[model samples]
Target: MAEWVHDLGGSRGFGPVEVEPGEPPFHADWERRVFGMTATVMAQGRANGSEFRHAIERMDPGWYLASPYYEHWLTGLATLLVEKGVVDREELEAHGAPSFPISRAAARADVPPGAQADPFAVGQRVRVRSFEPRGHTRCPGYVRGHRGTVVRRDGDHTVPDVEAHSEERPAEPTYSVAFDATELWGSEAEPGATVHVDLWHRYLEAVE
Candidate 1:
């Protein structure tokens, strides 16, 4: 059997979960370390010194839930590396086996603005444009093609898909958009329900 470590929220303490020996660890590569480091830097940059820690504390509330741990690690690592420039798109591709450029000369004409471009504001109405979905997609399975309004837009950041695979193209800027739960789930959904997700600018279109 394999043992996993977990933190109990609110100063309770850390504990272990036992699993079958052949079972895979949640974070096979344990990439969360990189993610945590990057998050810490970003938090400090935004004057939210304890933001990352606070998020972690809120997420783990005693009882353990089964989830794809490595996915979380990958998500966090991709975000941090791109944010801190520890792993650029070109570098990631180089690290991958037999690297090849994913972008064409036309697409490589210029560098796109990322987090350093401009600040995002709230109450912006946006629509997600349709695109060929491939690799890992952040555009949640449930919200595809669904019309919604942006309640809040978090600071700009690099898209994580390219980073996760080390694609040759540079990381594109992404925005955190919030949608009304009713809009996505329809009239049957709770009146005040809502869901927030990070989406790259390329994935959205401004709808009047």
Candidate 2:
């Protein structure tokens, strides 16, 4: 599977991480405002976490790479506001609108489905199923088709793929699967190392 530009967990060529010691969380006032807006939007249930993430992922790759971290949040917020009909594109462009609360109907629309039965057990061998997703997915590109052992069951959680584009928050069992470093990166990876990934039930299949 082709890696989405937003999902660069294990990829290379991005250079070293420069840490800003004692850095303030917000660089500018506008960034703080964007954070507030995002908090309010999510608090009011205008959009879910997965939906917001997918909106950021939907951004143009070049723009995404060029933009700052908070700008990505701002862009995702704007996209959700417009898509949810809370604000129109023209009103958003004008940037002079009165604030209104999100409707209760919208908040209550995503009543979560019942919890699903756990399909895989702890210490069970499984393989991540590889598939091309048409929409958002919690399954990362790096782990697809990889064999791993389920080390922990994370219980039921909302499936991101379903929540991203729809009003449904279906429950599914999640697991922390541990993959050997050498299994993923060949002999270059250090010995006695493992990478653990939290994955949903649907992403894995039992390996006999």
Candidate 3:
């Protein structure tokens, strides 16, 4: 599927960003509750950060746009809680969560074999793979199929693309890929502008 307008990418257009001269951390009491609950649930280990983000990414396009930022967070967090059997829709809709345990499978799942390779080095030219993912993916919509230079090797870490789907932990090296603004935004982009995106090894291919 093509990336939606809501997806973080070059194609997504935003009206002028609103500036808050002095913004409070949260706008309202409910927003605070939503933020706090999401944090507490993730901290309790009922869901990992990757899974929560994926849930948010998978939200319906209409709902995603129609809701406020914190509402989206609440929606994703609630969905994970129910899906993990921590709470049911009735309880969740009632604005109450029953007792829930941290997922042992998530903390102790065995790492996938042969997932620690670190072949690419800094300053290497690589292209983001053009894969339309049906599952949770770390690759951003903007950088797919674009070539960029590996500006930094961010060391190896657990791959979230797989972890979002299951308890399995697969590790891989990550890098910061720097792309010229023109390459992504066209010649109209200001000269000397660029964008840096952190990408995992699986998202990149060596440029010969």
Expressed as tens digits, the lDDT of each residue in 1-208 for candidate 2 is 2466777353456789779999999999999999999999899988889888877877777778788998899878887787778877678656743542111122222222333434798889999887757567777777888899999998889888788778766778889999998887789889999999998888888898
Any idea what lDDT model 2 has? 0.76
Model 3: per-residue Cα lDDT at residue 205: 85
Best by lDDT: 2
- Give the alpha carbon lDDT tens digit for every residue of 1-208 in model 1: 0011222111113356457778643344445555565557676663132222222222222222343554333434443444456667677667653542222111111212233423334566777654433333344545555666666555555454343334334444456677788876678788997777777765666666
Candidate 1: clashing pairs of residues: 26-70
Order by TM-score, highest first: 2, 3, 1
**Model 3 agreement with the true structure over 142-170: per-residue lDDT tens digits:** 78889999999888888877888787787
Query: So what's the TM-score on candidate 2?
Result: 0.85
Model 3 error, position 61 (Å): 1.1
Model 1 segments beyond 4 Å from truth?
Answer: 1-121, 167-171
Per-model tally of clashing residue pairs: 1, 0, 0
CA lDDT for candidate 1? 0.46
What TM-score does each of the candidates earn? Answer: 0.41, 0.85, 0.84
Worst 10 residues of 1 by lDDT: 1-10
